[model samples]
Target chain A: MNKHPHIRIDRYALVRNTVFVWLTAVVVAGFLVNIPRINILEHTARNLYFHVPMWFTMMAAVGVSGYHSLRLLQTGSLIRDIRAMQAARVGAWFGVLGLLTGIIWSKFTWYVGTDVWWNFDPRQTMASLQLLIYGAYFVLRSALDDPDRRARIAAVYNLFAATTTPFLLYVIPRQLQSLHPGAEGNPAFSDITEPVMRLIFYPAIIGFIGLFWVLYTQRVRTAWIKYRVIRDPEL
Target chain B: MEQEVQSIQDSLRAKESISTPFDSIWTGADVPTVDPSALEQVMLSNDKLYVVLAVVLLIWFGFIFFVYRTDRRLSQVERTLEDRIYERDDEV
Candidate 1:
């Protein structure tokens, strides 16, 4: 058995260590500091700082999957294939986050007639559909019995699905009318976005990113172990 | 003869050059150019924020569930490895 020469334990612990202190200090500091809470913020309280970052990190992971898919096709590496799979899985979770957050925010804003699970608004409709399309990439990979063929096909599918992200996230929202306004104009919440908002938002993003890394590593490790089990039954 | 063979190999390599149409993802018909501001509202009320928070939380919980479920299966593989090693030692 040829082991990888240099082994790194995913460095997930560093993320945990750094983020715990960073998130705690930011929360405490935000509470102690005299920051003007905007009227909209006063309604949601302080959840924006926490949830929006999760969506951003998820987008980033999906984007990574696209990149890895390209690399895998070019080089035919299992490492890239595994990373791509982990990223897609993690990205899907974030897709759910973005959808839920948007739906909930809509309810609070409208305060009437939003029982329908989905609306045809560009952001809501396109985002969910985009996720659903990418969701099939994993199904395609898993359904195949041959590893080499599976990776190759999944890479192609991933590349195709990834092209939709830019459209769904930035292009479609802009082309058609959307309920979500911050995407196009005054992205930093209405009024003067306090330095305090940045203070919370930045670490929250880093924390979510760290959390994504930890999950991505765990998924990859699990996949590799499963491969090992099937490959070497006795060992 | 060597020069002729070398020329033949060069032609074969040239024939293998990988090129295809549709390399550019941003081609005709798919291009979307419009001002994003022409879209609708972004401001949400306090109640809406809570709903959004709930949805985001649910997603996070889902991530936790899937990750742990997959990770737990790794223990089974490790156990199988240990049993195999034990069986081999007993035979020795």
Candidate 2:
């Protein structure tokens, strides 16, 4: 119904908006660079540096949703279910963006043949699995008719699927062969991050996180409004 | 991530224990570590990327703010109209 009729446009968030703007500029100008005049970024062109953080933020959101889903099961509250579903929905969007950007970036830099469609890298496989797990959440949501049962079963599955995120996406791959280098010890970050990479990478993480929060609030507001609108037609 | 790492480590401990992370860092790759002389140059190059990144963030956020503001305003107008309808009904 999309009835979020009372968002005040949080001033703090607006002020916070400046951070992302600054971050994008810093990463673009400072990090998309090379010296010795050689383009170390090469065909990757700054995409690789920032994209990782966005993907992680999205993953975190889904993980939170899973956590909340279990909480909902314990409390037997629809509110928790709503929150979980919405978080997953938002995470799905971020996941899509990350995967697409990664693919396009790889095509330009990593792929060398007509077979630029997919790679067997740990990063790619894990990412694909993450996507699939979320896809199943949507399937689970729709497959059942009883609202209570749907929430319960979906919540349980959410925990199960989300618990594997760290293993499938981070741990196992880091343990196994990896195409994305430096992931063995620190997939989240590289300690040798040049001050330049940090300039971009740090803000990229901030900006993406801000975007996630803004979307999250929007979802929450919309959901609350939807309930109000549906429950009270007079209002 | 930490939990997963611990889980992996627990298994490793059950197996033969590695002396330290240094042994693992020297895993398959044999890339030469940088010398002290090149430290200054590496730092400068990395800083350049930061400048580029800052610019991109500004533009990205500016666009987002514009969209958010527009949406907020539209919602405000919708809410006001809804209020006016109720007020008119009362007056009648």
Candidate 3:
């Protein structure tokens, strides 16, 4: 019963409720707020609130996972291992949603009349590759049977995966030609994004990241319970 | 077919007039154009707002799927606990 000493249930509940309300507001504002429509983007510009936040949330999740993995390496705490794995698991889900949403958004806007759903846009390609790297981290975990060995090995692999995330998601994509904004010689988001969109966009990012935290924490709590009862911390 | 091509060309011409660096790459003559399939037609309507709807729906479904996964884990834990309790009772 006393296994989850780290989790402050009351604090978690407060943040969870706040996020629930905050994201509701963000979604409402996202749709209701008006922006001057550009040619192809038109109303899909509203995706700025939804699709873009997913990547930001995934990045935040990666940061959390990486930090915990580092701590696990330093202190050899199974709790840190649990946190890292759950953060990665939740983060990868966000990445999946981000990629799928990007596909749908691009299909209509960029592909338009063409049947090309995937044209290997540099950012999209890099993003998928980044997800695969994280996928390997999970696969690597399942391969190892011993908990201590798995945690240490997975932590090392997680660190490597974390290192690749930024380059694949932001740096390499920017270096290449892509339809995504902030790509080589194209308008960066600051130049193209309207001030009105920023009102909702920034908050949406915060809300989605908060949502990630809640989900990640819930998983960690469950893992801790499992660890106490079954003496197996891997979840 | 000719009219569709004409309209696409006209739109390209219009885009060329105000093309940004990103726009020029996608709108270039090298890029092929096609008639919208019935599916594309449905998705591309209303300024492609349906794309936003679709993206939102995808995220919603993703969250639902995650919840189910967590639930499955919880169920496994519950089953294990029940089995352990029965084992202890049998020992008594």
**Model 3, A1-235: lDDT tens per residue?**
4323778766877887788778877876786677898999988898999999999999999999999999999999999999999999999999999999999999999999999999999999999999999999989999998889999999999999999999999989999989888999889889999998999999999999999988998888788776766673321
- The order of the candidates by TM-score, greatest first, is 3, 1, 2
Each candidate's number of clashing pairs is: 4, 33, 0
Accuracy of chain B in candidate 3 (TM-score) = 0.66
In terms of DockQ, the best-performing candidate is: 2
Candidate 3: C-alpha lDDT? 0.85
Worst 10 residues of 1 chain A by lDDT: A1-10
Better of 2 and 3 by DockQ: 2
Report clash pairs, candidate 1.
A43-B46, A44-B46, A104-B52, A108-B48
Task: State the lDDT at A146 in candidate 1.
Answer: 86
Model 3 RMSD in Å is 10.2
Model 2 DockQ class = incorrect
lDDT measured at residue A224 in model 1 versus the true structure, 0 to 100: 68
Query: Each model's C-alpha lDDT?
Result: 0.66, 0.67, 0.85
Candidate 2, position A211, lDDT: 67
Ranking of models by DockQ: 2, 1, 3
- lDDT tens digits by residue: candidate 3, B1-92: 55755665566567755647656335444544666566765565445656776786578657756765774676577567657656776887
> lDDT (0-100) at residue B25 of candidate 1?
21
